[model samples]
Target: MTHPTLLHRARVLAQRFGIDITRHPSDRTGDHLVRLLDRFEIDTVLDAGAHTGGYGTLLRGSGFTGRIVSFEPLTAARAQLHRAAEEDPYWTVLPYALGDTSGTIELNVAGNAGASSSALPMLPRHRAAAPGSAYTGRQKAEVRRLDELWEEITAPGERVFLKLDVQGYEGHVLRGAGDYLDEVVGLQTETSFVPLYEGGPLFDEALGHAQRELGMSVMSMVPGFTDPDSGQMLQCDLVLFKQSDAREAALV
Candidate 1:
């Protein structure tokens, strides 16, 4: 972040040239996410796979002041996540992974800042494409079912938005969400196009389960993990809203 005076001057200079530096045609994921939450009157955000509070920080930076409960299992990352939310009274960080059941699981720690760390085994394609994302070690992590924590984390009638970034564990998290999925108004999950993780569900299966079983319709698909050489998108973030929501309502 630049100094306030310098930022102001830069904005002023850009405005004189008939341009808005802050507004662009490229990906503005944060804006779209916050807009959806606001439109649906979301009171709380359940960040199912928060890694060092990145998504939670994105929400706060995107002007979402609602309560955020971020769940992370990695010890180091969880510590960092706690520090990130320490200043915000409404932001909370938990040291548990959301999965199909409550227990412990072995996580494949990635070599690169634990960004690629996942409960599932990393596949050769992922390691070959990004060496830094390869597994370096293993760690045991506590797991929790989202359904069991739903009522504890939220109040009745409070609209909720659940965000999942669990590498290949989207299905597990949703299954754990169970009947509480009906209570959620919207969600965003990272869907894999290939087998980046062993036993991972591919894009079509993930999409079908979300739409058919979860009762959601696609809102948007944003390119996420891409192969540097082949230029193929291995994963994408799929944002969906409940089919019961007012799709005909004006977004403007």
Candidate 2:
């Protein structure tokens, strides 16, 4: 599809799903990401990999008054996030990175500011070299497991919506967030069938793990362009919801 036509379709899909995608950048408010949170019934949102706070800003603008915790690991991006949060009282910006384990780890910074970051250990293979690569490099950053972070932030019986866009670290983030899985009503993650990040699991394997271990099932795919059951391969966003919560969401 042509760029304009594709964008028009995306806008229609976003409106159908009750998301304000027109104002945000395409990379930030794709159809899959919006649909994933469409059924969430909570105010508290966790915007993991919240690059420039686009999602958080959009949620609040759409009347989500609950707390939004935005996490970004990159120094420059975190600075932007902090500035964005300053304009909104409900949004909280954190500089720590999240993964399956807690410690300091090397983050591969890519040339493209948007897709240029990952915490995977095996980096040399996935690093893209170009003019963008000039801005790309590796840096040590503090990391924590989502489960641990959830324990510190969540209250009793509070519903949480999580959006994960950490290049290829989705599986690791989910793996470390076992405690928060049951509490999470919705999840929006970028999934890759190809090895975009070194040592990252394939999309199917990651989705299976989310379904079996995290108590979430596939709710939608990004761009609204793929069949949930189609055995095709592509890199896209994967929306997930707790099985029980999904049923309730459907009933609503």
Best by lDDT: 1
Which regions of candidate 2 deviate over 4 angstroms? 1-38, 121-135, 224-234, 246-252
lDDT of 1 at 188: 90
Q: Write candidate 1's Cα lDDT for 1-252 as tens digits.
A: 856676556644543332234443233778888887887788999998788888898888889989999999998888889989999999988889999999899998887678788999989888766766777899999999999998889999888889998989888998898898888888898988889998888999988987987779898887666665565768888998887665325443
The TM-score of predicted model 2 comes to 0.74
| TM-score for each candidate, following the candidate numbering | 0.86, 0.74
Q: List the residue pairs that clash in candidate 1.
A: none
What's the lDDT for residue 161 in model 1? 88
Clashes of each: 0, 2
Q: What is the Cα root-mean-square deviation between model 1 and the actual structure?
A: 8.2
User: What lDDT does the true structure give each of the candidates?
Assistant: 0.83, 0.68
lDDT score for residue 61 of model 1: 83
